[model samples]
Target: MPAPTEITVHQQSRVLEIAFDDGTRFRIPFELMRIYSPSAEVKGHGPGQEVLQTGKRDVLITALEPIGHYAVRPEFSDGHASGLFSWDYLHKLGSQQDALWRDYEARLAAAGKGRDDAMPGKAGGSCHSH
Candidate 1:
């Protein structure tokens, strides 16, 4: 994986732009990154325990703070700031976004949940259940 030389957050557009030292650039939508967050809250504690994040369609990242040169701590407007996105992880997310997103949508469909139904602070709404 290539190391990011610069990361920029476009608040208005709700996008995170990552540029690597190898001249590769990725522009990831905030909603996509938020939904695929690697945090335990989203990934759960083990396999087959991943929680589906709903109501995040409108979620936007408010801040991106660098943690050394390897990772970034993203702060979402929904008050979620636990996920520390690493360079490799971000790259993976960017690369596999389409498949991941499709999977997420399929999961939601299987669970009878809609993206708009995942409101913040609602119990049994959206969470990791490992």
Candidate 2:
């Protein structure tokens, strides 16, 4: 896998721009990242137990921290910071964004949900304390 040469978080555009050593670059949207987060909170522990994320259309990356030389941890405005996105995973996300979006839409439709709908029974609170 090609290593990332540059990574920039565009707050205004809500996208993470990454450039790889192989001259490949991608601008992945924040919404996509949050919905597709590879965390147990979102992905669940077992197959067919995935939690669908909603009301994340305007999710923001509050902070981005690197983990050694392999991955990055992002703190989102919604208090989600468990997912560590590796270079390979980010590259795959960038490359397959369109298909991912289609799958997301299909899941939402099958569940009779909308992108902006809030998750039911979710109590409003911070996942972390300051």
* lDDT values, one for every candidate: 0.84, 0.93
Candidate 1 RMSD to the correct structure = 2.8
When summed lDDT is taken over every stretch of 10 residues in candidate 2, the lowest stretch is 121-130
Write one digit per residue (lDDT tens) for candidate 1, span 33-129. Answer: 8888888888877887777888887788877888987899999998889999999988888778889889989998998999778544656745533
Encode model 2's per-residue lDDT on 1-130: one tens digit a residue: 9899999999999999999999999999999999999998888767777889889999999999999999999999989999999999999999999999999999999999999999777658424232
lDDT of 1: 0.84
Cα-based TM-score, every candidate? 0.87, 0.92
Full-model lDDT, candidate 2: 0.93
Candidate 2 ranges with C-alpha deviation above 4 Å:
123-130
Clashing pairs in 1: 55-118
